[model samples]
Target: MLLMPENKDQLVSVLTYHVVSGKVNAADVVKLESADTVQGEQLMIKTTDGDVMVNNAKVVMTDVEASNGVIHVIDTVLLPE
Candidate 1:
C-alpha cells in the first residue's frame, strides 16, 4: 500500500522501512532479489533499464556513509503493512 504517514509513530515506521541492514552498495544491491528492512519487512529489489528499485521506490543514490550505517536514497516513501 502507498502510505502517507499521518503522525510521528507512523512516520518513523515509514522511514525505517526504507532502511536495510549492512552496507550493501549499488553493485551488491542489484545482485539480491530481496532484502530485510530494519522495520521487519522484506523489500523486493529489481533492476530495469539500469536502475535499481526497492519495492516501488527507486534507489537514486547509494553508498552514503553514516555514523550508524550506510544510506541509499530512494525516490518514494516506503512503509510496512
Candidate 2:
C-alpha cells in the first residue's frame, strides 16, 4: 500500500517491517524461520533451495552495511494486513 506522509503511524509500521532491530546477515537470516521487526510483526523467512525468501519477497541482496543495522534488499515490498 502507498503510504503518504500524512499517514505517519502506518508509514512507520511499513518501514519497520522492512527492518530488524540489529544487524542480521545472510547466514544468520538463513538459520531462522522468522525475524521480529520493529513494528512488532514476525517476518517469515526461509531458504528455497538456497535462495532466501522473506514473506512473499525474494531477498535479492544481503549484508548491506549501515551504522545502525544491515539491509536485505527484497524484490517486492512486504505489506502487513
**Each candidate's TM vs. the true structure?**
0.80, 0.89
lDDT of 1 at 48: 94
Residues 1-81, model 1: lDDT tens digits: 325444767777777887788888888988999999888889999999999998898988988988987788889877689
Clashing pairs in 1: none
Please provide, for model 2 over 1-81, each residue's C-alpha lDDT reduced to its tens digit, 9 standing for 90 to 100: 446667888888788888788778898999999989888999999898989999999999988887778888999989876
The TM-score of predicted model 1 comes to: 0.80
Clashes of each: 0, 0
Say what the RMSD of model 1 is.
Answer: 3.7
**Model 1 alpha-carbon drift over 4 Å, by segment:** 1-8
lDDT of each: 0.84, 0.87
